[model samples]
Target: MRWWWQPRKQHGRIGRQVTALVVTTAVLLAGTWVGASRIPTRWFGPAHPASAQAALPVDRVVWAWAGAVTTTSATVVAEAVRPARRARLVLTADQAGVARSTAAVPVGGDGIVRLRATGLRPDTAYRYVVEVDAIADHARGDGRFRTMPSGPASFTVAVGSCARTGSSGAVFDAIRAVEPLLYVSAGDLHYGNPARDDVTVFGDLYRQTLTSPAQAALYRSVPVAYVWDDHDYGPNDADAAAPTRPAARAAYSAYVPHYPQPEPGGAVYQAFTIGRVRFVLTDNRSERTGTSLLGARQLAWLQRELVTAARGHAVVVWVNPDPWIAAPAGGADDWGGYPQERRVLADTIAAARIDNLVMISGDAHMVALDDGSHSGYSGAGYPGFPVLQAGALDRPGSVKGGPYSHGTFPGGGQFGTITITDSATSRVGVELTGRTWRSTILVSYRTTFPAPSTPPKPGTG
Candidate 1:
C-alpha cells in the first residue's frame, strides 16, 4: 500500500505505480537522475541499507526522529528492539558542555522508551545518543537536535510529505543540505496504511522508515514536527471512523518524539513555538468526521490557540496536513470537502484580527503557494492568509488545492522551506521556497510580517 493516491480519473497520473523496489533502484536511487525533476544526480544516494531495513534485528534500537523540542526541555523517544532491561538518553551540548542523561522511563509493552532532557539553553545545538540494553545494533545511536529559541531569532524550517511510503529518495538529502533548524513532515510520512489489527505493524513500519539510512540521517540532523494525513493514519482517505485509529494513535504516542499531544491518548494535535512564531499542528485525520475536518472540540481548541498565538507571537504558522485551498472537484479528502469548517476558521481569524497568520499545508503531492489571494474561503473574503502547499516527497505527483499565486509544479521528489528572520526593525521576514530533489528552487515568495504590537504573553498562552 502506497500513499493515498486514487484512480487515474480521480487523481490523474497519481496512480502511476512504482513499487518501493522499483523506486529504490531507479527513480529513487542515489546519484541517479530523478526522472520527475529532470535534474542531475547531485545528492548522496541511498544511505547504508537503503532498501533493506525490514529485517532489522530486534536488538537494534529504533528512534525515528528527535522532536518536541523547546527552549529548556526536549523529548527523545526510542523503541527497543525487544525485551530490554535499561534505556536512557545521553545528551551533550555541542559547545562543550557537561554531559547529561535522562533517567530511563519504563519501556512500554510496545517497546517504547521516552526520555525528556531538560535545563538546556535556548537555540542551542546538542548531540544525543540512545542507549538501550536490549538493542545490540546501536551503531547509529548518536543524533543531534537543536532547541528552539526563546526570543526573536532567525531560523529556517523545511517541510515535506507525500512520499512513497518509506522512500529514501534524494529529496531527503536535498532538504538536509539547507541545514534547517527543524523539519516539518506535513504528512504521508509513510503509505503503509497497514490493516487496523496490530499496532506492531506501525512500529515495524516506523522502524523501516527510521532505519532507512537516508531519512534516518536527516531526522538525526534536524528536529521534526509531524502530523499525519490519511495514508499514514490508515487507508486512503481514512477518517476518524478508521478502526486503525486507536493503533495509529498508540503507535504515534509511543514511537514519535512529538510535542506534548494536547489530547494525550486521543487526537494527536499539538502546538509549539520557535522564536516569536507559534506553530499549530492539527491532527487532520484522527478527529476528522464527515462534517468537520477537525471535529468540534478540536476545532474550538484550534480557534482558541490561533487567537491566543496570534496575540502573543509575531507570527502564527498553521501546520495543517491537508490542502486548505480547494481544487476543481476537490471532493471529500481535503479542506475543500468541509466548506463550513473553513468558513468557521476564516471567520474566527477575521474576528480576532489574526493577520499575522500563514499556513503550510500538505497531502497535495505538488508545490503551490497562494499569496493570500485565493486562499480565503470565508464569507465576503473576511479572513485571508498566505498559504504554501508542499510535498509528494517521492510519490507520483498530483495537483490538488488549486490555482496558486505562483502557479503549481506537480511531480515527485519535491519539498518546501520557510525561513523566518526577526530583525531590529518592526517587521519580521518570512520567506517560502519550493525546492526539488536536486535543491532546485521552483518558486519563491517573501512577505514581511509585522512584529506583535502587544507585549509578549509568554506563559499566558
Candidate 2:
C-alpha cells in the first residue's frame, strides 16, 4: 500500500555487484519489488522493552528463502517475528568480478520483511542477508541465489517433493551439493494436519521446514519454485472444495518467494523461464472438480502457453503435480478420475503441434521417466511425448502412472535432476535422472528438443 523512496547507503563495489536489489515487508501483504517481495507477517507480541529490539528473544520465527528471480530482479522473504520499522538486503558477489549491492528500503510492518532488486546480472551468484533496522537477522545462513540465466545457456535444476512435516533428511544436503540453478518443489511440501485451517498453523509448518538444518541450508542457497498437492493442501485426496484451501494459499503467498499467478488469491499455478526452457507449474488441487483438473481459468491459460511454446522456447516443462499418463487402478484421485478433461488437454497439445513438451510430476512416490513413449492420450492418437515422474523426498514410494520405458524405483529419499544444454548451433538436449537420498542414480532418460535456429531472446516468456 505504501510506495515511497527510502535512501540506502552502499556497502560494496557497485559494478561488481552480483546484481541490483529491492525489498518489502508484510504483516501479511505483498508490495512492490521482488527485486524481495511479500513475506508473512504473523506478529506475536509481548510487552515492548524499555530499551530496544536488540535484546528481544524473538526465536519463535526463523528462516529465509529467495525466489521469483529474474535476470534483473529477485525476491527474498522471511516470516515476521516482532515489529520493526525498516529492512534492507545486502548482496555480495560470488567471485572477484561479480556485482554486490546493499540496497535499503522501508519496511511496512514489524514482524515480516521482503526486498527485491533490479538491474542484476543474469546467472550470477550472490550471498544475501536481511537486516532489520541495521542489525542482521540470523535466519538466512550463508545463503545465496543466482538469477535465471540469460541467452543460450547450460544449467541444472533439481526437482523433488513430498517431505514429512519438519523433515531434515540428508537428501537436502544432496540437493544443495548439486548446486542447481533453481530447485522445484513439485507438490506436497509438508504432511502437516491438513484439516487445520489457521494461517499460523500452516505458517508454523513453513517455519519448521525452512529451519530444519539441512533443508534450511538448501533453501538458503537455491531459490525455490513450488506448488501444493493433496497432503499440503488438505486431507489426502482433497479437492477444490477443501475448506482450508484459502488459508493454505494465504500462507503460501505470505511465506514463499514465488512467481506471478494466473489469478490473484486463487490457485498458485504459474509460469517462468530459465534460459530457453519454459516451466509451467500447475495448481491441481485448488481447482480440481469432479470433471476438471486445472479448472476452467487455468486450462485456458495452458492452451495459450502451449500454442506459443514451440514458436518461442526450445523446451516446455509442464509441471502437473499429478500423473499425466495412465493412472494406476483405484487411483481415481488423479487424472484417471477426469478422463474427458484429460482428453481435451491431450487434444490441445496435439492441435498445437508441440513436440517440445516434457512433463515433470510428483505424488506417485517413485522416480521414473518415459522418452516420448506412452505419453500420448489424445483422441487423434497423438502417439508420443516425454514424462519425468519424481519424488517421495522422504515418503514411501508407490508407482501410479507408468509402463515407463525406464525402470522405476520405489523407496524413500528420491529426487530428479534436469540438465539442460541450449547451444547456438545444435539441438537443445534435456537429460533427466532419478536419484536417491545419497545422490545415487536409479535410472536415466535423455531426449532432444528443437533448438532455435537463430538466437532467440535471452529470457523467453
RMSD of model 1, in Å? 6.5
Task: State the local distance difference test value for candidate 2.
Answer: 0.73
- In candidate 2, position 321 carries an lDDT of 91
The candidate scoring highest on lDDT is 1
Q: lDDT per prediction?
A: 0.76, 0.73
Model 1 stretches with alpha carbons more than 4 Å out: 1-60, 134-138, 327-331, 454-461
Worst 10 residues of 2 by lDDT: 44-53
lDDT of 2 by residue, 1-461 (tens): 32222211222211111111222356116543421112111111100011111222344235678889887778888754466666677677677555455566665453555677677778878778777767776555246888878777889999998877766666677788788999999998888756867777777778777766667778888999999998888888888888788888887877788888878677999888888888889999998887788899999998888767656888888888988767534438777777778888889988888888888999987677788678888899986677888886766545676667765665456788998987754689889998765678877888787786654465424
Candidate with the greatest TM-score versus the true structure: 1
Worst 10 residues of 1 by lDDT: 1-10
